[model samples]
Target: MVKMLCDPVCPPPNLSQHPCCTVKCWKWDVNQITMNNLVKYGILILNRPITQNSGFIKNLWNRATIRMTVDGGTRQWDKFISGLSNEMQTTIKDPDLISGDFDSITDEILEKYKAKGCKVIHTPDQDRTDFTKAIMELNTHRKQTGLELSHIIAVAQTSGRFDQIVGNIQTLFLVKEELLLDPNTNVFLISDDSITWLLMPGDHVIYIPEETRQHKRAWCSLVPVGETCKYCTTTGLKWNLDNQSLRFGGIVSTSNTFDGSEKVTVKCSHTLMWSMRLPTIAIS
Candidate 1:
């Protein structure tokens, strides 16, 4: 029987006995990690067919193998299909598959991909987000084909409405660990830019790459979501805090940075959050 790894990611029971297990890299702040070594796989999830976002699709096509469209707020199936731009029309017609509720996908586009052997699955579980649905579908397809994907390039995942952006961010929390197993998954809110996620309990080194810009300076934050905290320490930032504990009303690591490569290490029971600005359409 093939060995199957289980959820709740952890190390092998007997490290010495097993002798061959994926090394678990620990980090606190994952700021400067690169996509240097990893199997790269791509999946595109569009809320609706693209019309004017041809540049986005072209960029995604450069990385992704399978493309998926999910039904969202727009409910007009025929209109949505007919309204797609020529480029989007071509992509949808030639994608690996189309999986989503048929509420918004027009008959024209649907028939086109289906005729080309695109497997369409109509999933209408309101409780589960469409983002989750597409991911589950991708995982299933990956298993069926015996293809191992390193990362997923999720396009147009953020945007549409305020609530959706929030839901999408929450979705990051849900899929963070699952993505770590594969090459690596990038969830783009919109355009070619992306939102990367990280967790706590390890030490991390972060820095802006030379390719991004001649000089990179932006705010870095460590937000403690859901609750307050106590004690915080950081380095390589304008405002340095050591042995300093923060609470709901206390100091938070917001809008802080240093001259050259900024390095940060922290020990926190809460999730420390950070965001930095980069050049347009930066994918690394």
Candidate 2:
């Protein structure tokens, strides 16, 4: 008999002898929701300001295998790293690709990365934002040249202009069609304070990483995001839903805590945007 993904038990225990044993069952995409099942994806750093000491940046930098920058993002990165020690400055964090409309990336920033053997691509299309162009490039390469990318983690602040925030969310909707080749390609928008992602029209389970939920009261909110989400059911949230209809002006779930649960599951008719607070260090 074939053992199911959750056979034996949930979240395989890490053996002391083999530290990497914690990565068991990570290769299978259909495995039960767990932090060990996190898929490797290319990191897309946006132009938004991200300080060097940001926990979100620290986490992604260690996790992502590939890194790319969007337009003026290089400027933000350059400025951020410049404040570090000389040893850290000497250690290069060269991006594999820097893409945008060329309006945001300064000439100095481009020259600096170019000297470090970075591939700077100038997409002059005015029809789309640099954010959208980056996605298109990722999709194009995936289809034509077999660029291996499971998904994308976009690191841009939510404190930017309201229009910019909407535009970033729009990319999530547009990329849905392009990523149909892989159902596990979940794109997430992460920042210093929170993480936001779109849950499709099916059962969705979000595994909160151990490091992200320790001793922190995380508030999660669900929004339809430009559509009326109907008949949604959820478990493991403070305000659990049961076949509920949520709309922009009608009913939306906000300020809902996680109730100290490791996993939050939602089944919905329409795609709903899920936003959760980031666990942070308490500075007394």
Per-candidate TM-scores read: 0.64, 0.80
Off by over 4 Å in 2: 1-39, 52-59, 143-145, 178-183, 210-217, 280-284
lDDT of 2 by residue, 1-284 (tens): 21222122122121333344332122212211122233356778898887424433544554665678889888887777776678766654678788998787779889989999988888999887888888777666566756556557787877869899999998887766444324445567866667787766656666654544554566779999877987899877878999999997888999787666677778777778888765542111
lDDT string, candidate 1, 1-284, tens digits? 11111111333222344456543423222222222122345555556433333343454454456655555322222344456677766554345656666666577667766787867777788776777777777778877887766456554533457786566656655565344233233333332333344334233344443433233544455666545546566666568777676666777776665545434445454445555443334433
lDDT, candidates in the order shown: 0.50, 0.67
| lDDT score for candidate 2 against the true structure | 0.67
User: Which residue pairs show backbone clashes in model 2?
Assistant: none
Q: Which residue segments of model 1 deviate by more than 4 Å?
A: 1-38, 48-59, 72-93, 157-160, 176-194, 211-220, 226-233, 240-258, 262-268, 282-284
- The number of residue pairs in model 2 that clash at the backbone is 0
- Model 1 — TM-score against the truth? 0.64
